[model samples]
Target chain A: MMHLLKIEWLKIKNYKAFLFISLFFLIGIFATNYIVYSVFHNIVNKSDAALLLSNFNPYDFEHVWQTVSYTSGYLLMLPSLLLIILVTNEYTFRTNRQNIIDGSSREEYANVKMMMALIVAATSTLFVVLTALAFAYSSEKDFSITGFSHVGYFFLKALSYNIIAIFISTLIKRTGFAIGIFFIYMGAENIIAQFLDVLSMKLKSSKNIDFGSLGDYLPMNSSDGLLSFPPTPLKSFTTSSLPTEYTWIVLGFAIFYLVLFSWLSRRLIIKKDL
Target chain B: MNVLSINNISKNYGKVTALQNVSFSVPRGSVFGILGPNGSGKTTLLGIIMDVLKATGGTYKLFDENPDNQLRKRIGTLLETPNFYHYLSAVQNLKITAGIKQRGENDIERVLEIVSLTNRKNSTFSTYSLGMKQRLAIAAALLGDPEVLVLDEPTNGLDPVGIAEIRELIKLLASQGKTIIMASHMLDEVEKVCSHVAILKYGELITFGNVDEIFINDDIVEVASSNIDQLKDALNLMPGNLKVEIKGNIVQITFPVGSANLENVNQFCFEKGIVLSQLQIRKKSLESKFMELTN
Candidate 1:
């Protein structure tokens, strides 16, 4: 297992793009801080929503944990883009073809790269958690921490998204196409669903607000959007998304994606031309 | 013992038949070359043996074990260009393969040295030239020191010197009692290295046999006589029973290579009143032999 890890690390070590993306991920943590801080501080705040958010604490140690949980959806991009390159570039570089020819089974190759993506996911999740903790402490010198129970919830949700990223990257196997699909699933594809919802609303027709269900096919919307419920700032004082059985559905789906993709990637890899 | 046995192995991809009832074997420690034109299923056959592909209708055994047996460790193959993460060094790539094989020995440095990539051990694969990558691929195959090696177009894209270097490496491995199965269209290269050759045409095995036997029996001898008509008649009565073709005054005959001849032929012709003007022996080049088998 350790040997496989070493091999994956060696493989990824030379990609200059991975380094650039990792650094960007680190910077994104700070970027989130700035966005949330500017919203809460009223310094050149232009929107009423921003003013309303002025009293909320994104950096407070108490709220930091909430913000981290809230922003996992945002932090997921780090692993998603990295994974796009990790899995898809193998096909483009023709290295996956060569690796298979050299004697490592395709499933072995897929699993090893998946394992590497898992590490990237684990660490990227860590960055979000650690930075959130740092911001929390910086904001409150005597920030008394509570709600340790939600940490498990945080870990599961974070794990599910990273695995989803790996699965998508593996299935698509093309960096450009995977990343584009990723962006669409994360943000744009749902616009069509939202537009559909709007047409019904203007007609004042009886339609369920639970229409977010359509996003499931889009991957990110059904997934990360599930985590978006139970507004973070409002519930910042007490973690309610935790112990909510409904979150289990989202968590379950994410886990399912990971397992399903793992099995599929393994099956298809052995038969590949390389 | 036959190290490999393929029993009517066939594979089809939906509408296209990639391989059809292809059958052949590699005897232990022999260098077997698979010769074919492009799209002739050379790689496909090798892939089936390695289990990189699932054959549609045939079965193959290696080392007396099934294709999926753990004995796969005893075989190393270079099916195409070497595949590994491009960011990794050659040693690192092999180590990853080592990890997958559950082989714990750290023979990476040694294999690198064998391929002469030790000097560039730290460099990323992207920096290595095409020949270096190929050598690295061969090094990866040799890492486990398996009993057999399968290489598909191993010398493709290499400089002539690089090709010769790899050829020598393969020859050396064969010398060490390893069964090497190489597939290529480069007839001369295969001819020089392979002890046994299998000619594949249109996804079928056109011919398979020991090189010395198949080609050795087809040597050429060019003879000319003053009385060509009488020479033809005399050659027909010869004891060696060589196949003779007359073109004007010159008659070319092919018999078993290195057969004792001409003196006996002269006596027979002299008794038959046929006078010989010229008689000389010649060897058949491998290319000619390949053409005979393939075309």
Candidate 2:
């Protein structure tokens, strides 16, 4: 597996897009957290809302992990886009066939790509951890690991997005088309999840029944649902009427989808002609 | 020992069959040619053997063992076209190929020099001309100097000089006791380089064996006269003529290989009181023989 990964590294080590996207993603993590960090530091601190908030600093050590993970989660799509381009580039260049012709088994080829996805997710998660630590230390608060689980959720979300990117790349086998479909699917899923969330709210209010959030049961949303804005006076005001958060069930669904997509991507490469 | 043994291999694309029950074995140390026209499933068959495409039915073995990645690493192959990372230089691309083959990482420079691309090895693959890209693919396939080579249209995009160079290179490699399986539509190319040949037409294997046996070099004599009928009759009665037939404005006589004598043909027509307008001996071209087999 390590030997296979070395070969994979050789393929992308000189790729301009790989380096460019990686640079943008690293900066995007810090820039996104900085933007959110400033909003609370500048406006919320001086505005009339500060009295109701009672001096809440989201970037403080207590909440920095959740804040950074949730804020950085939106930029997860960048790495996923990178993964899509890398995988689909093999098909675009027809090197996938060449790789196998050079003596790579279909299993080895597919396994290496999956390993790439895992490595990308791990590295992105590591960047998120670093960004959280940077913001937490700068807040001048005592160090704490209280809300670190949000970073773990961020890793799952990263892996979920990346595996889906690889799956779509294998199925679509074109760079622009796979990237387009990925964003389109994300948009379509969000709209449908919104409708389902509204329906779940209605069910809870009128029928006195609880199904948790049906929107969180979806593939992307299950992982997305794992991370949320940390509990605050402002956020609590809007949570009274929302459906209960079934963390365990949503976490289970997220894991199930990961395994399902991994298996599916592997099967497609193994059983089909290159 | 046989290098490759294919058993009843077949491939189908929906209702269209690309290969039908094709079976052949390539002996070691022989230059084997898979001769066929375009769209004749040559690339598809190689693809199946290299495990890039799934066989719809049947199986194949390499080096007298079940095919696997390890077995494939022993045979270098360039199938169909030049496939490489466009953004990478020729040297970089070869590195990836060598890395996959696991035995050619240190031999990149030597292979590039063999293909005469050593000077431009630093240029990106996308910047190469069609001929150069083809050369780079050949260079990659030559990495590690594998004992067997499967080249599909190996000279497809080369200039005349480049083509000649590759042909000479192939002969040189074969002289070194390497087994080469070449897929080409160029009959003359096969005739010049191959010791064994397999002819395929529309996905069916027509004939395969020693090149000498499959392509019997029968001699032909063409004679035309003022009276075509008299020319045909005289050739029929003449001795040593294997077969005689009338073509447009000419009478063609077939004879055993190297037995067609133009002087005898001309003399026979004159003795029959017919003045011959044209009498010429024609060597049986491999193209016509290939057409005869495929058609």
Candidate 3:
């Protein structure tokens, strides 16, 4: 596995687009976090900071991990796009065929892409941890490791997004079309999830026919459910706090989607001619 | 032992047949050529053997075992144009290939030197010309020092000098006891480097045999006289003539190898009262041999 990752690293280590996209992802996440942190640093008081900032907290130590993890979720698309470009570039350049001819198996090729996703996810997660720690030290909030589990969820969510992107890229083979489809799927899945949510609500209102949160089981929405902005504004609207049990359920759904996308990508790579 | 064996492989792209029931094998230490014209299923056959393209129906074996990644690792291949990350340098690209082949990185320099690309090893692949790209692809194929090398149109887009360089490199590799399966539409290229050849036309194997055997030395007797029609008639009267034709004032007679010499043809023409003005023996070329087979 490490050998395969090393091979994958060699292919992209000096690639300009890969380097730029990765650096963009790293800086994009940190810069966004910094801008949001600085914008609210002076406006919100300590007591209301938790409510106003919600999950964007760079100051508080107790919930800083969750804050950084939740805030970094917005930047997942950067790495996802990066993965899409990397995979689709192989098709564009026809190096995927060369790779197999040079002796790498289709399974190895697909596994290398999955390893790349893991590495990208790990890198993003590392940034989140580092940003959280730096903010905690600067703010001097009670340094507790209480909400660290959210970091784990953040990593899994990031991996799931990248896996899905890779799956789409492998299936589509064209960079522009793959990315276009990815964005379309991203938009369409949210609409479908919302439609399901609304339908379930209407059925309950009209006939008291209760169907549990089936929309949350969606592939994309399930990962989104893994972490969310603290709902200070929507407390009165509904579901003020995400239950621990619900987070676990979403984690299960996230894992399921991750495996499904990975399996499908492998199947496509192994079965399809480059 | 056979270095590679392809058994009744067939491939179809929807309605277009890319390859139909093609079967051939490369003996160990022999320079084999898959000779064919453009779109003659040479690349398709090589692709199927390398596992880059799937066959519609067939099976192949490498070194007497089913082909897997492990078996493929023992055979280096270059298919079609040189496919590498254009942004990466030759050394970098080769490093990736070495990693894929599970070979030592130190082998990179040796292969680079073998392909004569050591000076430009650090140049990005996009910066290299078509010839350089092809040489670098050969270098990548030589990385692991595999026993077999499968090359598909290695000189397809090269200049005369580039073609000569690749031909020499292939000869050098073959001299080192590497089994080379090269595909080319250029009959002379195959004639120069291939010990054995298989000719394909329209996805069908038309002929397969030893190159020397296939290109037998049929004696070409070029006979001309003051009366060309009389010389032709005299050559026709002669027994054991394979073909007789008149071009301009010369009546060319073809005879089977070792059957007729220049003296015998000259004596026959003189006995028939047609004294030869020009008489020469020319050996038939592989080009003509290929044209005959393909036609």
Candidate 4:
């Protein structure tokens, strides 16, 4: 597996898009968290609305993990988009076939791409951790690992996104079509999830029923629902009426979808003609 | 030992059968050719052997063992077209191939030189012309000095000179006792380099064996005389002739392959009191034989 990864590195080491996308993703993580940190420091702290929160700092050690994780989660698409391009580029160049011709088994070829997805997810999680630590340190609130599980959730979300990228790339070998379908699927799932979330809220209020957030049951949303903005005083005021957050169910669904996509991606490569 | 043994391999794309029950074995050190017309499943068969395309049914063995990736690592192949990362230079691309094969890391330069792409080694694959791309693919196949080579249309896009060079290269490789399985629609190319051939038409194996046996040309003796009917009658009386016919201004006698004797024909003509204006033997062309088989 290490040898396979070394070969994968050799393939992308000189690729310009790989360099550009990876650099962009790393910078985007830091820059995005910095922007959120500034908004809290400059505008929110100095404004008259500060009284509503009573001087609460979301960047404090306890909250920074969740805050940074949620803020950086929006930029998870960058890495996912990078993964889509990388996997689809193999098809575009037809190197996937060439690799097998050279010596790689169909299993190795598929496994390497999934390994890549895991590695990308890990690296992205590492960057999110660094960003969270930086913002947490600047708050001068004494280091704490509280809410650190959000970073773990962020890793799951990243893995979920990256694996889906690979799955879509395998299903749709064309680069343009795969990327287009990925975005379209994400958009469609989000819209449906929003409608389901609204329905779940109505069911909880009118019929005394609670199935957590029905929206979070979706493949993409299961992982997305795990991370949320750090609770502020204003948000806490409106949270009492909302349905309970079924963390275990959402996590379970997220893991299930991850395994499902990984298996499907491998099956596509193994069963189909290149 | 047989370098490759394929048994009843079948592939179907939905309702369309691409290859059906194709079976052949490539002997070690033999330059084998898979001959077929367009859309005749030459590439499809090679793809299945290289494991890039799965056969819908049946199985194959490499090196007389059940086929696997390790066995495949011992063979070098160029199938369909040159596939490489357009963004990387030739050296960079070959490095990736070497890494995968796990034995050619240091042989890149020598292989590139073999294909005469040394100067363009630093150029990206996208910058290469059609001929250069084909050459690069050949170079990749030559890496690791694999004993068995599977080439599908190895000279598909070469110029006349490039074609000649590749033919020499293949002959050179064959002289080194490397088994090469080449797929080509060009009958002359196969006739020139292949020691064994399997001719396919409409997803069926028409014939396969030693190049000499499968493409055996019948001996044709053409004789023209002032009296064409007399010449035809005289040749028809010949016991060893397969057929004797008057064609235009001459009489053509067909004999079994390698059985035509010009001296006997001349003596018999003189004894029959017929003066021959022209006497020559024509070896049947492989093109016509291929046409006869495929059409």
Best by DockQ: 2
CA error at residue B194 for candidate 2, angstroms? 0.7
Arranged by DockQ with the best first, the candidates are 2, 4, 3, 1
Candidate 4, B113-199: lDDT as tens digits: 988999999999999999999999999999999999999999989999999999999999999999999999999999999999999
TM-score of chain B taken alone, every candidate: 0.87, 0.96, 0.94, 0.95
Candidate 4 clashing pairs, residues 3+ apart or interchain: none
Q: What tens-digit string does per-residue lDDT give for candidate 1 at B1-295? A: 8889998999888989888898888999999999988898998898777666778887888776665535666677787666767777776777766755556247888888877889998887778888888888888778777788888899977888888888998899999999999999998888789999888987888988887776664567777876777687778877667788887669887777677476776677778877778887778787777777778
Per-candidate TM-scores read 0.84, 0.98, 0.90, 0.97
Show model 2 residue runs off by greater than 4 Å: B266-277
Model 3, runs deviating above 4 Å: A44-62, A137-141, A212-214, A240-249, B222-233, B245-251, B275-280
lDDT of 2 at B275: 92
Q: Residue pairs in steric clash, candidate 2?
A: none
TM-score of chain A of 2: 0.99
Q: Point out the higher-scoring one by lDDT: 1 or 2.
A: 2
Q: Candidate 2's residue-wise lDDT over B207-292, tens digit each?
A: 99999999999999888988888778777898753699999998888999877788887777788888988888888898888888
Candidate 3, residues B1-295, lDDT tens digits: the string is: 8888888999999999999998888899999999988899999898888888899998998998889988888888889989999889998998888888888478988888877899999998889987889888888888878889989888866788878988998999899988999999988889899999999999999988798788887878887878877777777888863699998878778888756688877787778887777889888887888889888
Q: What clash count goes with each model?
A: 5, 0, 0, 0
DockQ list for all candidates: 0.35, 0.89, 0.76, 0.87
DockQ score for candidate 4: 0.87
Give one digit per residue, the lDDT tens place, for model 2 in A1-274: 9999998899999999999999999999999889998999999989999998899998998788898898999999999999999999999999999999999999999999999999999999999999989888887799998889999999999999999999999999999999999999999999999999999999999997888999999999999999987788888888878999889999999999999999999999999999
lDDT of 3 by residue, A230-262 (tens): 444435456522222356677788899999999
Q: Which 10 consecutive positions of candidate 3 chain A have the poorest summed lDDT? A: A236-245
